[model samples]
Target: PRWRNIFKSNATFWWSFLSGIAQLLYVFGYLGAIRLTFMPTAYKTTHYRQPLLDHNGIDILRIESGYVACIFRMPSYDPSLPDVWQTDALISISIALTLFLPAVAIIVICSLLILRKLRIAKSTDISPQMRATQHQLLK
Candidate 1:
């Protein structure tokens, strides 16, 4: 009963905590999208041809390249270039959002709703039988 008063007193605080968790999720999601979208992929070039100087002229080597290291040299990679820092940051953020943030949000929202319903019951003039039934059903 005393603790019920505490929950009643802190309804706004619980709501704010839930809002904060949601806002954290929003911020992390936005940052993760940015990191994933604008990140550079290794450049690719196809059918690369060049002129060769011999006694009279020109030749070409048709090639496919992943990254152009220089005007004369192009390197190919099996996968795109890696950015360890960005990748790690994104992964850490995703874990925090997907795992930690949702759990916190759920706890805060459930607590807030329970407290709000309890406060509503307290404010309303309900019969003792009704209160017992509410507690039994809810708990």
Candidate 2:
């Protein structure tokens, strides 16, 4: 029974660590996706799966180039030009907050809970008989 209780406390600690790791992974995943979309990496091939056509029925083209560079390459240097990828930065930030913040919160809360549980368990009065038995067992 004593061993079982100790196991439970250790389990709580591990669960908190796992939750934090998951959140951190999610934040990185979102950032990586955005970077791949708007800010393509040199390693990831320029080509990714794209829809055959736009919503307006216009065909989409796949060029051997990065999207960010392509946007700036347009002639006339139109300062007022609308960007299709403008929302990506916002999405990245949102993902970072959603995944990373909650994970951190969960880790902190769980750790506090476990610590409280430990303190309470330790502060409980031990019966003289149980203490004697434990002492004999240790000897």
Candidate 3:
């Protein structure tokens, strides 16, 4: 006997459209959240007092109020610190997590569900064909 599960729809276009909308929403929400909340100057700087003149050749210290005046970032005039590389390092890790996390979660959930169904399929109620396939698989 065929497994007539209505969990599947005969309409391919509807599923495709739904999938496209879901993907677009995920991308838009992820990017929009990042854009809305991300601060360009979201870093701590170590203050240094120059004795006489330093490498950039000015004997004064400068500080500006942190603000996101516009989307485009102005060139940073602050002295480079060791922590600058940490931001760059986090970029790859963040990208990989964001891209694969949902996919991995879905795969894990589906695999668990399949395992559960297989466990129950050992019951005597299922079709002989499926039972035969089950026996073959167990072998």
Candidate 4:
């Protein structure tokens, strides 16, 4: 469609309209929201065993002992689930790759096509004004 007719695209025009509903559904489903499953928790490993002592060998900084505020974890998660899915890194990387790969591929392909078109427009004897307008609109 022409640049001016972009806003007047018909209902069947799917390329111009980008919706987030699919991503939302996929993300929620993949994360097991419907099943009330909260997998992949952080694990606290912070520790301080060395205590500061005064001249008399008394405990100077008596802050606390075993106070771990560093980690979160999926404590008491279901054991029936696969171990691979329980890992945060696996889930995150897999979900991102699966959801975004197709979109990224489509964008790259469309960008190449537009670039080719622009090159052709430039190679031809088209007015520089028209070429600039096309480039701007494509962008």
Model 4 C-alpha lDDT per residue in residues 17-104, reported as the tens digit of each score: 3334444545665555322222212221121112112112323234354221211232223578642223444455566567666655
Q: How many residue pairs clash in each candidate?
A: 0, 0, 0, 2
lDDT of the structure predicted as candidate 2: 0.55
Arrange candidates by TM-score, descending.
2, 4, 3, 1
Top candidate when judged by TM-score against the true structure: 2
29-84 in candidate 2: lDDT tens per residue?
76675564455444222222222122223222335432342122122224588534
> TM-scores of the models, in the given order?
0.31, 0.44, 0.32, 0.32
User: TM-score: which is higher, 1 or 2?
Assistant: 2
RMSD of 2: 10.4
What C-alpha lDDT, on a 0 to 100 scale, does residue 130 get in candidate 4? 88
Clashing pairs in 1: none
Candidate 4, superposed: residue stretches over 4 Å from native: 1-4, 7-89, 125-139
Judged by whole-model lDDT over C-alpha atoms, candidate 4 comes out at 0.44
Better of 2 and 4 by lDDT: 2
Ranking by lDDT: 2, 1, 3, 4
- The 10-residue segment of model 3 with minimum total lDDT is 44-53
TM-score of candidate 2 on Cα atoms, chains taken together: 0.44
| lDDT value, residue 80 of candidate 4 | 80
Global lDDT of each model? 0.52, 0.55, 0.46, 0.44
Clashing pairs in 2: none
Regions of candidate 2 where Cα sits further than 4 Å from its true position: 1-14, 17-76, 79-85, 125-139
